[model samples]
Structures are given as structure tokens and as C-alpha cells.
Target: MDSIPSGEGLIARMIEGDESAFTSIYRQYHPALYTYLLRICKIPSLAEDLVHDVFLKVWEIRHRINPALPFTGYLYRIARNHAFKTLKKLAYDEVLQEKVLEHLQFQGNGPEQMVNEKEYNRLFQEALGRLTPQRLHVFRLCRQEGKSYDEAAAILGISRNAVKKHMVLSMRAIHNYIYRQGLVITLLYLAQKIF
Candidate 1:
């Protein structure tokens, strides 16, 4: 019967780039880490991916692992950080997809409007580009992304009132920009309807 190495020995072996030591660590910790991530992320595939990412990071930073500290605690911290980052990216992707869909729908229901829609889209992009990065992010998160004020606030690390204020100001600026473009009243109506 073979005994598993102590945490200290395993850490040293991993720092030396021992594949078997890394495998041993993975086999010991992967299940618990997967379960913890699954509980936090609530998506099986995402949880599995995060667990894999955590282990990959651990392997990459193996030399930095401190054997004197609680290895399990360190592993969990890595898993937690990976899960949060993955979640944030997923949320951002979802929001971007929604914005694209909204833009498509706003274009029109018929092919006859294609040329006008293309020009309008160009101008709209320009308007968006004119916004300060922070205001643009806030607007996208709160308006185009359809996130609630609280959700935007939490994600942006700002107060709920601040999110509301940014949304108000952002919408006003976009409205004024479109109005100045002399596009049409329908464009203004569409903008108001969408945001």
C-alpha cells in the first residue's frame, strides 16, 4: 500500500514540476472544488470549467504555493476567484448579445429600410462613442443590458442611486445627440422605446 505524500512534500514536488504530484493534488481536491463552485455558480458546465481553470492556475503558480498554509483554503480561494471572474464574463457576454438583438430588432421588420438602418446604426455608434467610458459602461449595463439598477450597481461597484443617476444622464445625452443629428422623430421614438 502506498501512502499519499504530506501537503508539504506535495507542494515541494509540484514546485519541481512533478506531474504525478500535480495529478495527486487534482484527484484529491477536484471533487470538493467542483461541488463548491457548482453551489456558487449554479451551472454545471460553468462550474466544471471554473474548477478546471482553478487547477490550471494552481499548476501555473505551483512554485508560489505555501506548504505551511492550509492548502485546502488556498485552493478554495483560487476556485472562488475563478468562479467570480467567469460569472462576470458570462454576464457581460449575455448583455452584449441582448444589445445586439435589440439593435437588430430596432432596425426594422422589412428589408426596404436596410440602407436607412445602416446609416442610423453608424450614427448611433458614433453617439455611443462620444460618451465617457464610465457613462457608456453604466448605460450599457443598465439600459442596453437590461440589468436592474441594483444589479448594475453591484456589478459596477457603485451605489444604486449612482447607477440611476448615470442612466438618467446617459439617456439624456444620447437623446440630445440623436435629436441634434436631425435623423427623424421615429429615431428618437425608437431610442426612447428601446432604452
Candidate 2:
């Protein structure tokens, strides 16, 4: 079925115990939640299971949903909380924790992985080159030189909070630049493999 036009209407029907409306909600949000949970947990199978659990909770608490408010925010709140809780539980279970860590560790240490890592590092350097001079100085001081924020602030003649803000913005800019260039890197890798 196509997605319902009005979220409030769909949610109202869901609140009234309409299974179809609930199904519509599930179909609408499933992919986004899957991607989100997968990013947090880094395990596809576990992320799928967690998405199901999150929706189950949503169904159980359907009556509490305020249809007038934005549902995506509510859904993401539940997903974020559930993901963190599951990770915490995994951390406490030594056997399970070892298995998960082992799964992550051997995902790919091959030549292809090395090439991708190199590409990512190149992208990172490119991103760093785009930073403002002061931001670059702050980044080098705190990250490259391993200076404390207070020390960087004193050297730069800025407040500690200002140094902190520069670092945050610098990281954000670098991440966004790399993320935007990631598709090109992936396609180049694919082309190299095919050729």
C-alpha cells in the first residue's frame, strides 16, 4: 500500500487499533530505522532484530502517541534509546561482547580494505586543507600536537570554550567533506576491481 498522506490521520487510526494503519507506519519508517540502528550497532542481523523490537514497543504504546506532534522525532528517540541500551547490555555480557567484537575485527583486513582506508585518509587530508586558518591551527594544536584545550586556548589567546567550539566545527566540516566524497571513493574502488 502507498504511504498515507497525513501522518496524524494515520497515527490516529493506529491509536484506534487499526492494524492496517500500524502496518503503514511500519512500512513508512522501517528502512530509515534499519539504517539508523545498523549505523549505531554495526551489526546488520542485530539491527534488524532491534528494529522489530522498537516497532513492537511502538505498537504496545500506540495509545500514548500524540498524533499532532511529529512522529519521526518520537520514533528516533525510541530507536536511539533502544540502540544504546542494547549496546550497554552487550558490553556487560562478556561472551556476547567478544563475539560482536570479533565479528567487527575480521570484517575486512584485506588489500581492498587497505585501499579504501588509504582513500579515506586522502579524503580526510583534503578536508583538513579546507579548514579556516585559525580552525586549522586549533585542530593541529589539540589533535596533532596533543595539547589540552586550555593550553590551545592560552596559546591562541581565546577562551577554552572557543577552542572547544573550533574543534567541534573542524571535526564536523571534515566529516561532512569526507561523507560527500565517499561515493566517489566507492565507485573508484568498484571500477578498479572490475578492470
| Model 1 spans with C-alpha error above 4 angstroms | 1-4, 95-195
Global CA lDDT of candidate 2, please?
A: 0.79
- Highest TM-score against the true fold, candidate: 2
How well is each residue in 52-159 modelled by candidate 1, as lDDT tens digits? 889999999988988788899899888776665554454336553343234435654322243366766776787889989988999998778899999999999999
- RMSD in angstroms between candidate 1 and the native structure over all alpha carbons: 18.6
TM-score of every candidate relative to the true structure: 0.48, 0.52
Q: Candidate 2 residues 22-102, lDDT tens each?
A: 998999999999998887766688889999999999999999999999999999889888776666566456564555545
Give candidate 1's error at residue 133 in angstroms: 27
| Positional deviation of residue 195's Cα in model 2 after best superposition, in angstroms | 42
State each model's CA lDDT, in order.
0.71, 0.79
Kindly report which residue pairs in candidate 1 clash with one another: none
Clash count list over all predictions? 0, 0
Q: Assess candidate 1 and give its lDDT.
A: 0.71
